[model samples]
Structures are given as C-alpha cells and as structure tokens.
Target: EAGVTQFPSHSVIEKGQTVTLRCDPISGHDNLYWYRRVMGKEIKFLLHFVKESKQDESGMPNNRFLAERTGGTYSTLKVQPAELEDSGVYFCASSIRTSGRAGSYEQYFGPGTRLTVT
Candidate 1:
C-alpha cells in the first residue's frame, strides 16, 4: 500500500567517488523503473524491472552505472567514479500491471534523490 521510497534523499561527493542510491517500491507491484534528470536535460528513463529481471536498460548511459533489483522488493542504482555531469535528481517509480487498456495503469513516483558531484 505504500508508494515508492528512496533513501539518502541527498548526496554530495567528489567527481571520482562512488555513490549508491536505493528505492523501495509499493508492495505487489511488479514494475519498477529508474529515471534521472541532469542539468539542462529532461527526465530520462534509466531502466525498468519486472520482478527480479531487467525488462529494459537501453537508456542506461554508460558502464559506470549499474542497477539491480534483488528479489524484486527493492532496487539499487550505483554510479562509480562519478563525474560532475552526473549531478542530478534520481527518481524511482512503480506501477501495477493492468489488463490491456490504454492509460489504465499509472506509475507512482518517489521523492527523488538529489546527487551532486563536485
């Protein structure tokens, strides 16, 4: 019954440090997604998870970013050797699968975690 939740609402680190972000989705929801908005950029999808498997990851930027959903309960995103350009807000969302109906299923979002790389 809970909405999506993110940990460490804000993070600040040097350009080469590593940072990990976490997200917990609503119970009984099988669809989990990650998004981010960098400075001067639109919110872009990073990846999606259906249960414990990755459904889509085409949007992931590069090899420095990694995401995982263990047991499909919660998800984690890690950025290694972070760059200044990575400073942005990371958002997580979840949705319940609905029957074939346009706009029937709505995705609930979490309070984004803001990351700043100096």
Candidate 2:
C-alpha cells in the first residue's frame, strides 16, 4: 500500500544550494506529516512525526529547515542554504491513526518537491 513517494519531482536550486527532499510513506503508516506552500501561503506545517519521535515540530520554518525520520519508514526534508523564500511546494503527508476520532484523516499526498531558488 505505497501511495506516497516524492523525490526530484522538481528542484532548481541556486540561492544557496543544499536541497534534500524525500518522502515515502504508506506502509503501516504511523502518522507522518510535512507540508509547505510558500509564496501565497496556506499550506504550512513543516513537522509532525509519530514514529521516529518528533510528534510535533511546531511548523518548523527556520534554521535552514531540517527534518528526518530514519527508522520510522521514510521521511527526509533538508533545505540548507537554499533561500529565496525557500521556493514552494514541498508536501509529504501520511495518515493512519489520529486519535481515532476520525475528524482529520486521509492524508496521503506525495507529488510535490518543487523548489526553485533562483
């Protein structure tokens, strides 16, 4: 049941270099989230792991942006010197369990990785 996998979809670095974006979730999902939408704003939640710790990073959007979920399946988002507003489009969502309330479920998106920092 692999429904989330993002990589090199579109990356044009230049601002400062360093860009590592990779996300693969959908196997026994334990809840993994990392959203973004620079420019117009709206989608902004760059942290939320539930397997390899980091249950909530409080929307990380600084410190060069760095996220990882090693043994938790697959999840990586590293944006080093890359600046220029960090470009946009960098989503990696995975859902399976969220308190069982079923109020905010269905998070399986992984077709984004477009970072153009010119």
Candidate 3:
C-alpha cells in the first residue's frame, strides 16, 4: 500500500500571496493530520481530521491558515497572505483510527512540502 503523499514538494511565494498544499493519505485510513516545522523549530501539530470532520484544530497558527479534508479522501492546507513566519516544511500524516491511547497508533508521514514566503 502507498503511504501519504504531498504535492508541490516545494513552493515559493510572496508575502501576500496564497499557497495551497495538498495531501493524499493512504487508502482506508480515517485519521489525517497536518503539521509544520517553522524557523528551525520542532514540528508542531496544526490540525487533525477524522474522516470528513475536523477532530481538533487547536494547534492552527491563525486565521490565515485553513485546512480541509474533502470527502475524507484527501486533505488541503491553505495559507492566505502568506507570511515569512509561515515558511517551513509542511508535513502530512495519516493512520488508522485510534481506539484508546492517543499516541498508540503508528502514523505514516509524507515527504513534506517546503514553503518559502518572501
């Protein structure tokens, strides 16, 4: 089976431009997550989607970032008016639905998209 995959391995945009990152998770997986490592900082969780519903989005940086999982197959993360601070390696991960422990399941990750905002 194929693992998660992200499009546009790299993107460079102006500060006020918009960039959308897409992720295709492994088939049959119901849990999807978005994460990023910015300014050389450790990777941080951005949001999570269970099927087509958002389970948690508390880690999203701000209103400028929007994430969506359409039809529960693929997910997209868009950053409007991108800022220099948003430049980072954006990662997408997926796994089977967790039952009890939150961190018990093994998540598969994509190669990640490197975004550069100038």
Candidate 4:
C-alpha cells in the first residue's frame, strides 16, 4: 500500500565518479518507471519496467547508465563516470495496470533524488 520510495534523497559527486540510485515501488504494482529533469530540460522518461522485464527503455541516454529491477519489486539505476550534465532530479513512479481504459490509472511518484555532479 505504500507509494514509491527513493533512497539517499540527495547525492553529490564529482565528475567521473559513480553513483547509484534506488527506488522501491508500491506493492502489487507491476509498472515502474524512471524519469529525470536536467537543467533547462523537461522531465524525460528514462525507462519502464513491467514486473521484471523492461517494457521500454528507448529514452535511456547513453551507455554510462544502467537500470535494473530485481525480482520485480525494487529497482536501481547506476551512472558510471558521471558527467556534469548528469546533475539533475531523478524521479521514480509506479502504477497499477488498468484494463486499457484511458485516464483510469494514475502513476504515483516518489520524492525525487537530486544529484549534483561537480
């Protein structure tokens, strides 16, 4: 019954360092998504997980990023050799799958984790 939760609400790291972010979605929810908003950019979808499988990941930026959902319960995103441009607010959301009804389901979002790369 819990909403999504993110760990280490804020992170600060220098460029070329590695950072990992975590998200725990609501119970019984099969849809989990990751998003981010960099400076001067709109919030963009990074990837989506339906249970343990990746449903969509076309939005993932580059090879430096990796996302995984283990056991379809919690998810993690890691950025290696982080760049200054990676500084942003990372958001995680989850929602229950509805029967193909438009506007019938709403995604619940977690308090975003702010990352700063210097």
Please report the candidate that would top lDDT against the real structure. Answer: 3
- Indicate whether candidate 2 or candidate 3 has the larger lDDT: 3
Those runs of model 3 whose alpha carbons end farther than 4 Å from true positions after fitting are 98-104
Worst 10 residues of 2 by lDDT: 97-106
Q: How many pairs collide in each candidate, listed in order?
A: 0, 0, 0, 0
lDDT agreement of model 1 with the native = 0.92
Between prediction 3 and prediction 4, the one with superior lDDT is 3
List the RMSD of every prediction in angstroms: 1.4, 11.8, 1.4, 1.5
How should the candidates be ordered by lDDT, best one leading? 3, 4, 1, 2
Per-residue accuracy of model 1 over 1-118 as CA lDDT, tens digit each: 6788999899999999999999999988888999999995999999999898999999999999999999988999999989999999999999886676543258899999999999
How well is each residue in 19-114 modelled by candidate 2, as lDDT tens digits? 999999888887889999988779888798887888888889788888989998898999899989889999998988667657337788888888
Task: Tally clashing residue pairs in candidate 3.
Answer: 0
TM-score of 2: 0.32
> What does candidate 4's lDDT look like per residue over 2-102, in tens digits?
77999889999999999999999998888999999999589999999999999999999999999999999999999998999999999999988777855
lDDT of 3 by residue, 1-118 (tens): 8889999999999999999999999998899999999989999999999999999999999999999999999999999989889999999999887677675267899999999999
66, model 4: CA deviation in Å? 0.3
Task: Evaluate model 4: give its TM-score.
Answer: 0.93
Each candidate structure's TM-score, on Cα atoms with residue i matched to residue i, is: 0.93, 0.32, 0.94, 0.93
lDDT of 1 at 20: 97
CA lDDT, every model vs. true structure: 0.92, 0.87, 0.93, 0.93
- What is the Å distance of residue 94 in model 4 from its true position? 0.4
